[model samples]
Target: MPSIKRKVLVLIALLVVAFIAGIIFSPFLRETTYQLKNWVGKPSPLPPVSKTVILYFSTPKGELLSPVERKIPVKKEINDEIRMVIGELIKGPKTRSLFPTVPPETKIRAVYTKGDTIYVDFSPSIVKNHPGGTSGELITIYSIVNTLLENFPSYSKVQILVGGETINTLAGHIDIRGPFKKNPEMIEQSKILNR
Candidate 1:
């Protein structure tokens, strides 16, 4: 009985040592674990495919913003898609009749969604390079707010931020201290599609 007990203890100890060594020396096992983790919870590594997205841009007359159909790469993640949408908006409209609302030099630093509110962070150039007028600010703010709400129904509102900090206004006109909802009245009367 004593010999049997000793053999059992040795077997258990050998199993533990082998398990530890496998963890330490086996790269395949370690890589498999990492891949499993990513497969379960992380976004896919495959590049997002391009999709048609309607982006709102200020018209040349500045009377109201107009919708322009644009093809942009959209990711599986909603935040990533929002970032891509904003990046395309900054690139300006291809049509000569429409113009960009955000500054040409502005860069989107980050984009995130919390509950129904989407927060967009832009570089300081959004404010510094802005044309700074009531109409311009309204177009800029509404263009962003409308674009997000129009594209993704999951988001109800949008909050603009500069360098991750919220300001009272984008260009000292419209109050942007809180999230802004879509204003259908600000869109062009003729261009308002059934959404």
Candidate 2:
């Protein structure tokens, strides 16, 4: 009986050592163990949670912007979250009735905050690929500004930049040299699409 007890103790020790080694050396095993713990309801660092954000797009019939909801993974930092939001905006609206405001070729270069202002830097395509018009430019600019302001109320304004430098305009229509506040006048307040 004593020998059997010793054998069980040895087996337990071996398992503990193996578990420790797997966690230290094997990424796959570590993920599996984390998942197992989740399944077993054991307390573990929760997976990155997702939050719903409202993205603005141009309404097909008129020049006004419309809001659409999307689910995005929550980021550890606010700046990363801002990037994700803008990335989603570039992807365009999921609803058929709403038109995409940002140029498809546009790429986010950087996003940062200072006091109550957020600066969003984009690639040159935002200017080069823009459709070009007062109405079009208005829609595009407000689409980004409204999306950011709506999602993060803490940031009161957004400054648009291109290729790491501040730009005066997207397509020579609206003045973009200064930071922009949320223009509720440009938004279609009644309609909100979920996707």
Candidate 3:
């Protein structure tokens, strides 16, 4: 039988070897052992390792604009702005005066969103003479539709209403009941890029 002192010496040697082996072969063991030592009983005071992730907003041009990007609330999408841009484009090459002629009384009431369809509401003045003839009206309406549908391709149809009332003709032509599809005529040189 070994003496108690000799047994103590043997146990100490084994513990030292285990400690060294753990340090060299597995760093995880040290962490587990430390945690176990602290959590033997009662509540464990140590905090768990965090694994949360956060995302930052960025433009297509790779410009970072997030917590540090704006003093005022920033819009993540430009669907409305893009649609307006198309409207300005429809007003003609010299579209700088488009806004002033919009008629303050004639304003967009609301835009109803549905699956692949958008219903845009405008004031009564929209039905007024919109400069161009049937072609002008076609160009105007289609410009808005095509631009919107392009900016948001997910949508397949668009409907325009005048002062909460659905008009039969934009300028004595073109049907307005059904949601209108994108107008191919408005698309520039390259209409639909397949690739």
Query: Highest TM-score: which candidate?
Result: 2
* Candidate 1 segments whose C-alpha is farther than 4 A from its true place: 1-48, 191-195
Models, CA RMSD each: 12.4, 11.5, 13.6
Estimate the TM-score of every prediction: 0.72, 0.76, 0.48
Worst 10 residues of 2 by lDDT: 39-48
Query: Per-residue CA lDDT of candidate 1, range 1-195, in tens?
Result: 999999999999999999999888799888899999988996659764787787888878886988877777767788888988888889988767778899999999899888999999999999999998999999999999999998988889999999999998888988888999999888886653222
User: lDDT tens digits, residues 39-93, model 3?
Assistant: 8867657653321211111112222111111111222344454335434332332
Model 3 error, position 191 (Å): 11
**Alpha-carbon lDDT of model 3:** 0.53
lDDT of 2: 0.92
Clashes of each: 0, 0, 0
Give candidate 2 regions above 4 Å deviation.
1-48
Rank ordering of all candidates by lDDT, starting from the highest: 2, 1, 3
Model 1 scores a TM of: 0.72
User: Candidate 1 — what's its lDDT?
Assistant: 0.87
Give the Cα-based TM-score of candidate 2 against the true structure: 0.76
Better of 1 and 2 by TM-score: 2
